[model samples]
Target: MFDKILIANRGEIACRVIRTCRRLGIRTVAVYSEADADAQHVRQADEAYCIGGPRPQESYLRGEAIIEVARQTGARAIHPGYGFLSENADFADAVEAAGLVFIGPKAASMRKMGSKAGAKELMQAAGVPVVPGYNGTDQSPETLAREAARIGFPLMIKAAHGGGGKGMRVVRVLDEFMASLESCQREAAGAFGRDRVLLERYIGQPRHIEFQVFGDVHGNVIHLNERECSAQRRYQKVIEESPSPFLTPELRAAMGEAAVKAAQAIGYVNAGTVEFIVAPDGAFYFMEINTRLQVEHPVTELVSGLDLVEWQLRVAAGEPLPLRQEQVRQQGHAIEVRVYAEDPDAGFLPGSGRLERLRLPAPSAHVRVDSGVVEGDTVTIFYDPMIAKLIVHDADRPRALARLREALAECEIGGPKSNVEFLERLVRHPAVVGASIDTGYLDRHLDEFMPAAEVDPDLLLAAAVAQLLAQERAARERAAGSGDPHSPWALADGWRLGHAGKRELAFVHRGAPLALVAHGSGGDYRIEHAGHDVVVNGARIEGDALSLRLDGRGRRFRVDSDPHRVMIHDGERRLRLEPVEVYRRQSGGSAGGEDRIRAPMPGRVVLVRARPGDPVRAGDEVLVIEAMKMELSLKAPRDGSIAEVRAAPGDFVEADAVLVTLEA
Candidate 1:
């Protein structure tokens, strides 16, 4: 095996590769961008180097710079961990040319399988089952539209050089086809530097199942069962598992054979995945082949009991396959959930901020966490927002799922918004638990998944009242006149004799304002107009916050005295309150409306579709902003004349930056 290897990537996958390398006694080198200078993966590596700026284009994708780092560090091999330059044939060739081993498939094989159009043609020629669509090299808009019509409505317009769901669109009718086509082309060009696209018949009830295939220099290849990646959102996989619950023994055998055949057809070596779109009718069609270690490789590793990274090292060092196809066996079921720093309520938009706290669930024999971040780390908008991959392994699928759910519940992340609750709901969804999943599952049940309801007002009030009483008790204890330091009467000495005095306290719950009234009493207090009469006992003050036992709920409310913000922890949910300040406003007449276009988030402007004096309708694409590895099109909010265009292509923008203005 190679003595030292360089990981040409960052994030969880980089850390994952380093772990395996350490186990095999191979020293690892990590490359990072400015954004990841203090990242977890950098600390885990034996040696590290900063490649470039925060953006992937300036850092991870700089294949030549990474190759130089590997050379300077005297690394014998370079492992392209999943994204960035992993599937770049040129990068692989550069490594090989520099006398360093590329720890993946040969460059020739990658070239053949890199493009979706080329791979489909190769698969068809090799007699592999491919989807019925237009794989021809025709880029004319009319020609593609005609092919889409022939393939029928509800077809997929996929970028020939796409992955991670970028540059992909599903058009359900002819009316949406042309616009979607243009959008897909623009995104594809921006993401992959390729505008070529292909049409595929959309499978209604399709399950994404892919086999993990490995090969050695001696041409021996074997399949390591399969992973079901059907749980997806926005065409990107969210949860993955192996072995697939829907796959029977017979189907597994057939799919395994087909995967091996597909690999052999392209002279594939090292670790690669043969992805298939398996239909409900038991027919599987070759979607495409990933020419590197997959992001969800941990699931297969758990079931197969193999270190794919170690295998990559050994194979790159000119070793033969250690085990044959018949020798490999699936041991147990494993499930992996990709935890991302995104807000599910905000269209799953990427959230960026410093991580205040990251507490992982205690690991047992079955649970494993592969993470590339920690507390105090900043989640920026420069790359993918995936925080970690939580994997659970058990003897059965149900047991694995149960462990996964428990682990997710136990994990606590207190920084930016995340989809932890959404993930919990997804795994427990009846269709997912019952193994009745498909690509369209999330889209069909979006309403049930994402609900827009305000929190229970009574619960919020109870928490606020509990907090107020606790604070009063603590203040009394700290007073100098109280012989009993913890006496509640110390602070109540100033209460008026005739009637109860009420003080207005402001509370903000879930971004909404609330006014709370706290009435003074000897030892107990009544919350006037509160949804529930919350009684607090055994009050204890910790720092600026107070802890109280209320209503047998075991609830804890931490009140920030200065900000007047209270955090109510009621087991599963948290209620946040910020004091609502009343401000006098000037009375005025109804204001006239004006048209404005704003950037949704901080990003670099990629395209400007309109300029001043141009007339546009509502919903017309006015500009495109690239952020978090995805392109978001800023549309015209209303029918108007373009009055101003402030942003140009290649200009950086901040959140809510004015990109355009329209005249009503």
Candidate 2:
């Protein structure tokens, strides 16, 4: 193995690679952008260097600068961890040209597999079953439209150079084809620097399953079973697991052989994934090849009992294959769920802020956490907002799914809004637990998961107790430093000298105002809110954990707080409660108007389709905004004329900033 290796990436994957390098006595060098100067990956590396600015264009994608860093640090090999430069054939070739080993596949293989169109052609040439679609090289708009017509309606327009669901669109009708193609092409060019696209027949009940394949310099290649990535949102995989519940032994064997064949055809080296789309009828079609260690590689590692990173290192160092095809085993089932710093209620828009308190579940023999951020770290807007990947391994899918829920409950992330609660609901969803889901499962049943935000009684109770506890603690700390510990001014709750009848406290949950009234004193209280009453026998707070007895039932809740906001974490749900200030005057002529269209989140306006006075109907795309590399479209709320366009293309606006105004 090489003495030192440089990781040409950031975030959890970088940290993940560093761990294996350390295990094998290989020193690791980490490259970071300005935004990631104090990032977890940088702190974990033996040596670190700043490549460029926060934006990927100015930083991680700079292959020449990264090569210079590798040279300066005397790194014998460079591991391009999944994202940024991982699949860039040019970058791999450049690294090798700089006399540093690229710890992945050969550049020639990457070039062949990098382009979706090229890969489909290669797969077909190699007799690998490919999806029936237009993989031709005709770039004319007329030709693409003709091909779309030939493929029929309800087809998919995918970027020839896309992965991770970027630059992909599903058109349900012929009328929407041209517009969808334009949108898809724009996204593809912006994301991959390639405007070319391919059309494929859309699978009605598709299931995403990919096999983990590895190859050594000795031309030995083997498969590590498969991972079911059917649980997706916005076409991106959210939950991935090995030993797919949808596949039988015969099907698994066939897919495994096909995956190996696909890898061998490309002369693949190190770690790569052969993705296939399985239809409802059990027929499978090749999707494309992921030419590097996938983001969801941990699930494969858990089931196969192999350190893929370590294997990659050994293979890159001119070693033979670690194990033959027959020796590899898929022991236990493993499930991996990505925890992102995105708000599920807000259309899952990516969130960026300081993580005040990030407490992941303690890793054990069954649970593993791969994260790139920690407490006090800031999840900036420069990159993916993934908080961590929670992986759980068990003997079967049912047990693994159960442990996934438990693992998510043990996680506590405070500051930016997260999708942990959503994930918890997902794992427990009937279809997921029963293993009867397709790629469109989440999209079809999104409403079942994202229930209307209402005042949860348990959450309210926990919040009230947390607030009371926090006040008492503050009072005690103040009294300790004062001259008299018994001073009435130091007491927190206003319950002295029988002066209590009905005390009211106001709060805001999920942006809706709440009025809570408590009757009685002396440690006993009857709380009323939203036509519901709860008898709180008593409550106690020890640190950030609150113990409360509501209606004679005791429960413990973990709480985190700031001055005005209190976050109550009960089981898998996290609720944020904001205390309403009594002294503040309520002056509003309606905070939001139906005619105004606001940018749901902070992002740069990428395109504006509606001009001033333009007529539009509800759900019409008025503008598009890009944030954290994902594009979101703002639509017209009702049938109206665009009264004004407040934002122009390339303008960066803050969250909730009005971007357009419509008039009836």
Candidate 3:
């Protein structure tokens, strides 16, 4: 519709918008920070510009700088893809004031829905069912405490202007109310630039259902069914699906109608999502409305057979509704899982580093991968640490689930730890398989989804074989160069005059020592471990797969390895193994006795709980840092006196930097 448009965001959403704009013959302009100078979005766009530094406030969130880029590139419209300034009403108004289309809802609509408290009040007036809670404008602490007492225990304290699971807390008891409130307000102030909060009655074991709502200037609004996002961890959706399996036809129609009402009440234009929390008894209440294209919109697109971005473009160009309410249809089931750069076992700590070996399932008609990164990209701590969104669609839910497992198996991520294995386990858990998962289920039953601490013997064996074979191959390749290829020392295949000497290899898995002795070579070997002997044949690595035969039985595994680490995926789970030297270095003895505390990940220091000369116990909170949209408290390792605090509040430190020092 327009000759050019600028994407006011980065990452996968920006890349996604560029694809649609390119398809429509519209030139796309991308703006990035210093950290993202070589980003995939920049390379893909027709024109690109560097706005500012790496941090969001320095670049992506600078509405004026982005507007200037659009003007310079001659972009007629700007797409604020889902995050950052997408929900900022002032930014939308600024764009319009600069004579460029915002490409989303009207500024008035955004302003009305910008605050959760205001949105809830508006929804209630529009006849949409809203949760019974406090949304009043009383800003005093005493008023909030009074409201909490009246509302009873187990209430939710949510930031009025925050999303993405930030600035939210659940208070379960009366005494814990003030502390939770303080924490929630502090986070809200830091993240959203506002400390205002709203109280809601916390619903236990609730299912998160959100309907995709679209509206145009013609005042026509329609619903695109609903997405079931109940599978979550810490209020963040882990997996999302369309046509909620828990929803009956009658309930679906009712919620869909109410979603339309909420959108119409705000005069929302372009694309938006109306989220609801449904209780077990079929009672649903309005949670909030996301005022732009959602991250999980692909699942809706796959099921509804429509491109939501294209619709956003047409709507911004003054086109009428693409189809009426009666014509909206959902064809099949679609599911999406967000793969993030995080460690699930380690308190879900977010990670950032170069993707040493990144591989994903090839995209096809039934499968799609929305990502802004590739194999060599570094997932800096400057923004969200999401790697990609893996989506799968099929004729039905069962088939879709089956395809998802296969697709997950094909993925192999190296370097920064990921939740891919955790997600794989979750999909097979009984509750997930039966479609009975709830928002708190993952947190309650997290142990069930975690792999056993001890690695499987078979898995360890595969790791040993893969490493030995790879080493032998490397030796042979070295021999072929400047040395004699026929030398037995170079081959190192247990060669001898009488009988081949057994080659002994030592490995470690989950802190357990593993010893293996191999005989023979060249894709054939007899291996011994734990006083047990077996014959292995056809052991070779092709790409990432390792196929081998042990004791006349065939086995296959996905192997990602280096001199330091060995990752073996045996169809269902991943096992981390390492050479004895590497393992020993990793399990360093000084880690626990270290006097200084290093920053776990790159982030800004938000609090220093202990100053120099302050006494603290082992479990006392010493400092707190926020990274990847979550807060991590650094605690004292042992009872000691703080000797120094290197960083202060608002100081951005790199990973492994010593931020605080204790008495040595």
Candidate 4:
């Protein structure tokens, strides 16, 4: 084994690789960008170095700079952890040229599997089942259009050189083919530096399954079962599990053999995943093979009782296969959910901010958390917004799902919005519980998981009680150092000469102003809001938990608060209450108006399709901004003529920056 290795990626995957390296007595080196100077991975590694600017183009994708870091740190091997440079064949070849071992498949094999078009051709010839599509090398726009017509509507246009759900689109009709093709090509070129695409016949309601395949220097290859990755949103997997509930033993064996064959066809070495799209009839078609470790590899680890990173290290060191295919076992079921710093209600818009309060479940034998951040760390805009990966394991899928729900309840993230509540609902949905969800099910029925915009009367009272108790505690703490600490003046209970006065507070709930009136304090109160009055007693906040009574019923809720908003959680339901000054006036403008288009996150403007005086209809894509490796289309909010275009191609803009405005 190599004495020291350099991790050429950041975030959870980089930190995860370090853990296995530490276990095997290998020193780990971490490389970071300016944004990740004080990142958790940097603190955890034995040594760290700053490569370049925060953007991926300036840092992570600079293969030469990464190679130089490996040389300076005296790292004998470099592990490209899942993203950034992980699947870059040229980078792997360069690392080999520098006399450093690349801890993944050989460059020659990566070359064979780099292009989705080429990989499909290779797989068909190797006797593995591949989807019928256009894999030819004609690069003309006319040729692509002609091929789309022949392939028929409801086809998939995927970036031939891209993976990870970027640069891919599904066209439902021929009328939308050209536009989808252009958008897909642009995303592909931005993400992978390649604009070539391949068309595949769109499989309806297919389950996305993939088998883990490993090969060694001795030309030995083996399979590590499969993972069910059907629960996806926009081609990005949200939930993944091992021992797919939809697969029978016979189908598993057949897919496993096909996966191994696909790997051997390319002389694949080290770790890789052969992805497949499976129909309801047990028939499966080959999806592109991922040439590096998958983001959801923890599910495989939990079921198989093996460290895949450790296997990659040993394989890269020229060791033989750890175990033959028949020796591999799938003991139990495991489920994993990716918790992201995104707002599900806002089209799952990813955000970057400080994690004012991040509380995740503690790791146990049954639970695992792989994250690179802690409570005080900031999730920068320079990379993926994955907060954590929550993995649960048990004797069966039902038991594992129960653990997953319980573990999700233990999570409380404060600063930026998260999908914790959404995930909780997802795990309980009938489609997921019954293991009947397809790849497009989440997107098709998203409203079923999203809570109604209307707030409940009980929730308002709970928020009022929780907020009042929290304020009372702060007041008591302030009075501790005063001369007359016990004086009633320190209290904020609206004390009057003969009767207790109502303490009025202002809050914004569901975008509407809410008036709250509190009648008492000292763990007892009456809350009146929206013509409803309720008596509350025993209201107190301890740390992040709130216990109180509303009307005659006892209530308890989890409280996560920052200066901006207070989030109250009761089971899987959550209500975000923003406290405002009682006398503060409201600010309004067209920045968030129907005639204006604003950037949802901090990103670089990649393309602007609208100019001054251009007529556009509602929902027309007027601008595209690339943020954190995803292209966001800023659409026209209403049918109008474009009055102004402030952002241009290649311009970097902040969150909520006005990109375009239409005539009122």
Candidate 5:
């Protein structure tokens, strides 16, 4: 085994590689960018170095810089942990040229599989099942249009070097073909440095399943089961699971054979994945081959009882195959949910800010959290927003799903918005629970998955009462000097009065206010509101927060809260209460009355579609902003003339930055 290895990536994968390397007694070195100076992965490694700026091109993607770091740290091997330079054939060649082992497939194999078009041709030549599409090298617009027509409408235009949904577009109509083709090419060229694209017939109700394949230098390859990855958004996978719900034993065998064939065709070695699009009729078509460890490898690991990274390192060090295909067996079901720092309500735009509070679910025999961030860590727009991969394994699929749901519910995160609520809803959806999933599942059932109704009066009242009681108890503790001895209440003298003092507490529940009167003293009290009297005991007040026991239920509430707004936690969901003064009118708002265009997210302006005094329509593209490797187009809000173009191409702008103002 290698004595020392350098991880040529950052974030969770880098941290993941470090763990395996340590277990195998291999010292690990980490390289970071300026933005990640105190990143989790950097702190976890034995040695660390700063390569360059925050952007990938200047740091992580700089092969030479990474190689230099490996050399300086005396790392004998370089593990490109997925993304950035992981699939870059040139990077692999450079690592080998520096006399450092590349802990992945051979550079030659990567070169062949890096291009989707080339991979398709190779797969077909190897007698593996491949989708009928145009994989030729013709770049003429006319040829592409012709190919699209031949392939039929509702086709997919994918970048030859695309992954994670970048540089891909799905067109269902002939009229939208040309524009989508051009856009796909532009994005493909910008993202992958390749304008080449391929056309494939869009398979309706398709399920994305990928097989994990591993190989050694001794000409042995084996499959490690399949992962169902159909739960996706924006063409990127969101949730994945092992032992696909739709795959039978017979189908699994066939797919496993095809995965082996696909890997062998490229002389693949180390760890790789063969992705396929399975149709509703049980027919599967080859999608592409990833030439490195996958982001979702944990689910496979959970079921296969093997550390893929360790295997990769061992294989790269000239080790022979340790196990044959017949020896590999899957033990149980494992599901992985990708927790990302994104706003689900805001079209899933990546969120960036300091993680003020973070409470991860405890790991047990069934749960594992692979994370690269901690509380107070800033999630910048410099890289992928994935914060952690939460995986749960159990004896059965239903048990695994239930454990995963519980785990997600226990995950507490604050600061920037995230898709935790959305993920929680998705896993609990009826169709999802029934294992009836496809690419269109989310889009088709969006209305059914809106935030759960807030009209449960009983639950709301219980939450409010719990809050009030907790507050009263905290107040008693403060008065008795039993809590926070430095508190001002501890210094106050208690005076007996003929009549108990009444304090009016107003709280908003489910967008409505409830006025309650606190009666009695300290341990014994009754809260009266809405013609109902609730007995309270053991009430305590600390500062503005409250804790109390009421009617066999434990409730905690915060009062003396923000006068304008208060937040209530009901153990399941958070309720926001705002004073009437701060509430805005929700009805009859003017639509598209101005031409002002705003940047959707913080990013560099990549393209300015219009200039000052330019004529524009209500929905015309005004500019394009690039953030987190995705391009967002800013559009005119109304039909008007462009009065000013405040931002030019290459200028950085923050979220909601005004870019173009329209003249009425």
Candidate 6:
């Protein structure tokens, strides 16, 4: 093994690589951008260096700067952990040219598999089943349209060089073909620097199955079973699991053989993944090959009882295959869910801010958490907003799914809205629990997860009580610090001896103003709101949990709250409430009005569709804002003339910032 290796990426993957290198007695060096100066990965590594600014292009993507850091730290190899330059053939060649091991596949192998079109062609030559699609190099729009007509409707337009759900679109109608093609090409060129695309038949109710493939310099390649990544939203995998419920022993073996074939055909080295789309009839076709370690590798590791990173290092160090195909075994079932800083109800827009209070379920024999952030760390718009990967393993699929739901329920992430609650609901869904899922399941059944707009009285009471109790504690603490601990005014909350009838508290729950009246003091109080009186016998908050009693009924809820907002998680439902004053100031009455269009999240305006005095109708696309690498389009609220365009393309605006004002 090498003495030292540099991690050419940041975040959880970088930290994950460091742990394995330390185990193998290989010193690890970490490179960071300005935004990640105090990142967890940097603190975990033996040596660290700052390459450049916060943006990826300014730092993490700069291959030469990373190579220089590797040289300076005396690292003999560099691990490109799954993003940025991981699949870049030129960067892989540069690492080798600089006399440092790339710690992954060679440049030739990456080039052959980097382009989806090229990879499919190569797979076909190797006698591997491939999806029927147009992979030719024809750049003419007419040719692509003709190919789409030939392939039939409801086909997919995918960027030839794109991954991570970027630069992809589904054309369900003939008229949408041209528009979808343009959008896909634009996104493809912007994300991957390659505008070429391919057309494929869109498989309805197809399952996403990918096999973990490993290869050594000795020409030995083996498969590590498969992962079911069919549970997805917006073309991205939300949950991944090994030992797919849909796969039988015979089908598993066939897919495994095909995966190994694709890897060997490309002369792939180190760790890679061969993805396939499985039909309902157990027929499978090659999707594409991920040329580096995947985000969901932990599920594979847990089931296979092997450390893929260790294998990567061994293979890079010129070691032979660790185990043959027959020796490799999968012991149990493992499932992983990616918890991202995003709002599922609001089109799953990415959220960015300081994590004022972050708490994760403690890792145990059956549960593991891979995170790159801690409390107080800012989740900026500079990179992916994935907070952590929560993985759970058990003896069977049912137990693993149960454990995953429980783990997500115990997770507490404050300040930025997260999909933890959404994940929990998904796991508990009947279809999901029964293993009846597909790539479009989440999108198709999103409404089932999102509850009705009706408010729950218990949740509202809990939020009000918790906030009141917290405020009372703060008041007493401040009075004690002022040397007035004996004062009765400071000692009593909602019981000031003289003026004590009903103390009203105002809050906003899901945009509706709420008035809560508290009648009593100490731990006992009667909360009345909207003509509903809820007798609170007792209420107290311990960490992220809140124990409360309403009219002789006891309830315990997971509460993640700050001064401004409080999120109450009750089983599969999560309710977020904010202080009325804070909400008013943030929304400013014009948020839902027809007079102005405001940004839903903080992001840079990438496309401006309306100019001053331009007329637009309801649902007309007005602007497109990019945040955390995801684009959201703002639309006109109603038919009106654009009085003013407050933001232009390339301008960074905060959440609720007025982008365009309509004439009143």
Among these predictions, the greatest TM-score belongs to: 3
Q: Write the per-residue lDDT of candidate 5 for residues 1-664, one digit (tens) a residue.
A: 8999999999999999999988888998999999999999999999999999988888999999999989888999999999899988998999999999999999899889878898899999998998878979888989999998998978999999877778888899999999999999999988889899999999998999999999999998889999999887656787899999999999999999999999999988999999999999999999988888999999999999989988898899999877889988899899999888887666778887788666678888899999999989988877888888899999999999989887876665666667776787788888789988887777777766655645344344444444445455566666676656566444322223575555456655434666666665555566676787777777565663456667766776533233344444444444444444443331113123465677666788889988788888878888888887677877888787889889988898876667888885
The reply for model 2, stretches above 4 Å from the true place, is: 138-155, 164-197, 496-498, 520-523, 541-547, 554-564, 569-574, 581-625, 632-664
Whole-model alpha-carbon lDDT for candidate 2: 0.87
Q: Show where candidate 5 strays beyond 4 Å.
A: 138-154, 166-195, 453-455, 466-601, 607-620, 638-664
Relative to the true structure, candidate 4 reaches a TM of 0.90
The ten-residue window of minimal lDDT in model 1 covers 582-591
lDDT per residue for candidate 6 within 42-97, as digits (tens), equals 99999999999887889999999999999888999999999899989999999999
RMSD in Å for model 1: 5.1
- lDDT (CA) per prediction: 0.81, 0.87, 0.89, 0.89, 0.81, 0.89
In candidate 4, which residue ranges exceed 4 Å CA deviation?
137-159, 162-199, 541-544, 562-564, 582-598, 607-624, 635-651, 658-664
TM-score of 5: 0.85
**What's the lDDT for candidate 5?**
0.81
Going through the candidates in the order shown, the clash numbers are 2, 0, 0, 0, 19, 0
lDDT by residue for model 4 (1-664), tens: 8999999999899999999999999999999999999999999999999999989999989999999999988999999998888988999999999999999999999889877888899999999999878978896889998998998878999998887778889999988988998999899998889899999988888999999999999999999999999999888898999999999999999999999999999999999999999988989999878899999999999999999999999999999988998899999999999899988888988887899789899999999999999998998777899999999999999999999997998888877778988998999999999999999998899999886778877777778777777777788988998999999899877788887667887788646788888998887998777787888888878887888878779988888765556778787677877777521332244248887789888888989998899999988999999886678988998899999999999898987788888898
Lowest summed lDDT across 10 adjacent residues in model 2 is found at 582-591
The residue pairs found clashing in candidate 3 are none
Number of backbone clashes in candidate 6: 0
Question: Could you tell me the lDDT of residue 65 within candidate 4?
Answer: 94
Report how far off residue 254 is in candidate 5 (Å).
0.8
Q: For residues 1-664, what per-residue lDDT tens digits would candidate 3 score against the true structure?
A: 8999999999899999999998999999999999999999999999999999988999999999999999988999999998899988999999999999999999899888878898898999999999888988897889999999999878999998887789989899989988999999999998889999999999988999999999999999999999999998877889999879999999999999999999999998999999999999999999888889999999999999999999999999999989999999998899999888988878888999898778899999899999999998999887889999999999999999988998888787877889888889988898988999998998899899886786677787788788888888889789899457887678767777787767888887656787888888777887787788888888989998899988888999998888888888887888877789987885565343558788888898889888899998888899999887667899988888999999999998887788878898
TM-score of each: 0.83, 0.88, 0.92, 0.90, 0.85, 0.90
